[model samples]
Target: MPATAPDLDSRAAAVLGGGATHAARTYRPAIRVARARGSRKWLVDGRELVDYTMGHGALLLGHAPPEVVAAVRAQVEKGTHYGAASVVEVEWAERIVAAVDSVEQVRFTASGTEAAMLALRLARAATGRDRIAKFDGHFHGWYDAVSVELDGAGRPVPGAGVPASMAALTRVVRADDGDALATALSDQQVAAVVVEPSGAHYGRSPLQPGFMAEVRRRCDETGTLLVVDEVVTGFRVARGGMQELLGVRPDLSLFGKVMAGGLPGGAVGGRREVMELLSPADGHVVHPGTYNANPLTAAAGIATLDLIVDGEARAQADAYAERLEREWRCVLSDAGVAGRVWRLASIIHCALDDPDAQARLPGALRERGVDLLHTSGFCSTAHDERDLADTVAALAAAVRAAARVRR
Candidate 1:
């Protein structure tokens, strides 16, 4: 922590249990952001950094983009929360339904976690099954039912505070293991099979190209619902999302991040019949949130979606990410560092073959004025050639620093 940060560390420790709201933000020598614009963030102590975290994979248009900010500012005067339906919410849902092929109806939630939970519940209600299947290492959210990891025997193991009984309800299968997936769903006991279409951990471990199609096939064969968790990839990877890129239609899609235009909101959008279960007419399921489709988020979402519906922003961001991937590979090669840089759409994943390099890379890059989420980076439409050059140079320096430390 910088001395000039003015008690950010102590304030964080006092207020935030882990000295940070999110685990990823709890880096040693913590940085407190004072403000951000475009692809850069200025720390509280006045240190400027080229940011790649991009709101933990939100902000597809980049930090505080003028249009989104303008919409939010305009909506602030009207009201923040009405606790009732609004035209903005209806318009937001309309855009989502129009964009996503599988979504005929949509329901809003306060976060992706809630959206996912509701999607699963909807699945259970539709299928009359209690079990859900998921790919190993595929993160849906922090919710207990979806937070389990696979054990040595490929069984689901719950995270701390999550009951083993709840974990057992989730069947974990290996990603890309067609046979395991088939076997898991063969019993027809599962209500849904959920996955991140961008692969596990948002492309840290990328999925095979045709694996999702296979999932779709298996789901159809087993009469199981396929729930695509597109919280990070929705509207960021493509206008419609990874489902559009892959040409697979999920029964239910969980969306957030870009969908809310950098605001805090999420949605469960899918087949009308399944989503209609939440309707009070039948009263099949109860779903409500104080901030669900709040006017501010709705306005921001509409504005953001309007710009990206043409796919220009997404294409530009993807092109930028591709360039960064190529350039970073060259950077690692030139430095005699062993690392791999790969990308999916606007997201970039870097993995150093050396454990020491892997461990030190993020901190080293931060010191060199670049910030990434774990080993990944997200490009935005706001990221330009200058940002790319700065990021590559910073990464190269970080690689060299890690090598020196290893020596």
Candidate 2:
């Protein structure tokens, strides 16, 4: 017989770090998912929970959409890896170039982190500058070069294991602060100005209107390449991601998540001149990865991109998120809780006025059979009227429970 949830948790604790695969997934009583489909997951202990994580923003169409599943299954029969270039990858690249205006060329990577690393390298190579500037609270992946941020004193603070010398190469500027951003780029020693066009942490604290355009102008003035990290926003927020919505073209854009159709893959797309830095004939940046644009990921990415080409899938997901956001606000108001819910397309973030209450909210929601990605929710096209009703019901219960605990 399969081990119970508690038994699995105990065994996991003995082997896994903090009994969780990812740090964000750690909970006091870890919930074990047996299987997930559509907007719901079944726990090992037989409890059914409404799922809002949605593959950490990868499943804009929801878990295992038939088209994507069929694509992967068909490709699996061909082979997972050809060990050489395949036609599917070219088709995938063509889809990205056609969708995103800023992306004239595309280079696939194993994950978003690799994409980020490659993008910075390209920026540095193209500009012949070593320093990189980034907005405060903008996450570009777990790489050492992009892991540094400002401390309370506004000094660069590198993450553990990141060298101080390496951190010095990254100039941290506050998001939406045009003066500080301008100052960061005025030196002209900065190769790239990397940003998340949706703002920091996927819009928990959104950029003010026109902030991205301002950043783009500054980058142009300083001869710095603008690298927009669209890993979370790509294809989920729109068919072309945030850059399309904002009408701001970047020199380079990083994409993952929805573009890969719930699979593990990412790409750096940008102007031909900058992206060609990876080409051996004209440039010297050589990137080699065994699984880069492997057959399986290419098939899934192609299928996902095909479905979202017309933008209807993005519209459906956004509409669902809009309803969920409204219902969340109504729940907070009804529960007499001090909190606010905001959204960026399909991603929803819930914040309580009381920090302690906010901290307890996730646990409370889980108890009511609603699972969120951290404190945010990722809506999908697969969510329907039933999911809407059940999610609102769960939020109502969870808010009341959190309020009682606060009292």
Candidate 3:
């Protein structure tokens, strides 16, 4: 097993940059998954680990969900690609439109990043403004426009490969700072004020109560389009995402992850007038992608959406997460570990008092046969009592291990 692991590791390093496709997927001691099903994944060495990543928040129904598998299987037999419009795609979009109140029209993209990019483009086109504003630490995607972060002075600092001039067009403000947000939008040159209603890092830094409503009001006052990046929250948080929970409507909403049923897909749904910018009649925003609403994705998405429409899946996941949150908080307290556990819907976040312990927590969990998405655990409807108990024990051990490590 060790011999095979090193060989495969070397091969991956040679072919795949960083030995992983996505940055988040990379691990300290690279893990190779052999297979997965229902809240657990087996490593190449045949080690089974409780999976909390849950397809990075896509698998609300859990891994290899039967309905999605059946749908994708049936679609593959019919056709993988038609090079034209698809009925499954239409149904998927219909479900999104019906589920989300703010989304009157929707357009699919290959990934969340692309969906975010499209939303910004549409906002700029619809408002005829060059500048955009986003809250600091609220990551929309990896695209140039949304890649910038704010420094300590609250100044916008663009990531590498972003032009200074392009960075100049963005305004960065704190998500909890309503006054700052108001001041940022006062100029009225901003096309869109994009945000994650749950705040940055999937509620690690949660929005203050009523912050979203205030954001909506500010956007309305300044005539700026509000784009909510719900890529991580859509479908997983609720049927309609954070906007529904917050009772605020945005001009544009981004969807991905759970909305795509663990497939590679994303979407921008928004007001009909603004979305019409992409229509042939308007020719305002042009979007083209090879895999936009591809049949496999649409099939999985449709099946996933159908199951979650009744809110049962979300309820189940949330219930499990609630238990996890309670138990984990107790674990930290009982173990005398300086950490706190919090949750937003089905997503659980564990923050250590020591920054180094926080950094080591995920790796420690992986070693204890549990995998997390950073310091967060994404619960699924499939997680049951056994998985919960095991995860709790693993978390307790991992916290102790992480806390013992010296800088």
Candidate 4:
């Protein structure tokens, strides 16, 4: 095996600027994926890898899932985008409504970011409030208004390009601090609270039992609306996303990733009266998109839900997660590597907590025939015990290789 990866740098730089189409994948070098199928991806340089990225949490059923592919193939023949309404869209919403306890009305978007933005708009319009509050580690879409702060020096620093004025309208609070949330809500200027119920993306933060209940209590006590961002946690976490698992209903919820079965699709679902504001008939808010409810996405989304509704696959994935999460921790410990295995059900994050850590994990893992998912790994329905054991060993070896490099 070559110590230095091949064609990754030049090819990426030549075509994709900064070596990637998306900022996250760019890293410093580049990550080139050739093709994927069933829990794995083959790299362009001829390396086969156990893929934990899985379309960045989109492939709940795993790569090129049979049902999802069939749905896409069938829909493509009927034509991809009509820029018009279709029955597939209606059925997609119906499935979402049935699965989630809080959703009565729904709107589709091209990405989860858009769904969240729309959710915020509707919340503000309906509540007649100007400010939106969210936990520190949670990331909503990249929209300027909501994307305006990062926890710097234990205080909010205005995110670049976010007007200092608009910065004042957005409030940043700790995900665990119920008192701070209450204060923001009491301001009466807060329109909504958007949260990732499991706190997966925010440092893999774990919400203490009843933390969600506290949030629900706070929202009800004040006039604030709650928006749960389920882009990463939607189907994979559980059938109805974190809301169902936690038993605390929010006023609005955003869905993406696994919801599309690995296609480009997103949605905002919530109570009827609030969502009614999005209807053009009502003089409140607006929701529009070129790819909104396109037949291809709708078909793919419907197929994805069909596979998730029964919760059998979810159970399998969660079981695998428990096994792998524990095994990885053990392996890392045995290797004398310093890190912690942080997980939320099937979602596993290996935080490299060591100060001496100096190697890039994606490169090290790729060299060992396994794909890296931003320091985390998700177990798919297709990953059985065999895959889990193999991955744990692979990660153990990769950590040794990484630890060998001179800082």
- In order, what is each prediction's RMSD in angstroms? 1.8, 1.3, 1.8, 2.9
List residue ranges in candidate 2 displaced over 4 A: 405-407
lDDT of 3 by residue, 44-138 (tens): 88789999989988899999999899999999999988999988888999999999999999999999999999999999999889999998999
Please give the lDDT score at residue 32 for candidate 4. Answer: 61
Better of 2 and 4 by lDDT: 2
lDDT of 4 by residue, 289-391 (tens): 9988778889989998998889998888888888888888897788787788867877888876654453466677766777767777877888876677678
TM-score per candidate, chains pooled: 0.97, 0.98, 0.97, 0.93
Full candidate order by TM-score, most accurate first: 2, 3, 1, 4
Q: For this target, which candidate reaches the highest TM-score against the unseen true structure?
A: 2
| Clashing pairs counted in every model | 0, 0, 0, 0
lDDT, candidate 2, 1-407, per-residue tens: 87798899889989997778886878778889889888888999999988898888888888889999999999999999988989999999999999999899999999999999999999999989999999888998999888988889988899999998999899999998999999988989999999999998888889999999999999999999999999999888877889999999999999998888888999999999888888887559999999899889999999999998998988898899999999999999888899899999889999999888898888989988888987999999889999899889888888888777453
* RMSD in Å for model 1: 1.8
The parts of candidate 3 lying over 4 Å away from their true place are 1-3, 405-407
Clashing pairs in 2: none
Candidate 4: 10-residue stretch with minimal lDDT: 1-10
lDDT of 3: 0.91
Question: What alpha-carbon RMSD in Å does predicted model 4 have with respect to the real structure?
Answer: 2.9
Q: Please, what are the lDDT tens digits per residue for candidate 1 over residues 1-407?
A: 55566487887788988888886777889988888999999998888999999988988899999989999999999989886779899999999999998899999998999999999999999999999999899988899889898889866789999998898899989999999999999899999999999899888888998999999999999999999999998998877888998999999999999989989999999998898899887649888778899999899999999989998999999999999999999988888888788998899998999888798889999999999998899999999988988888898789899766343
- Candidate 4 local lDDT, residue 164: 78
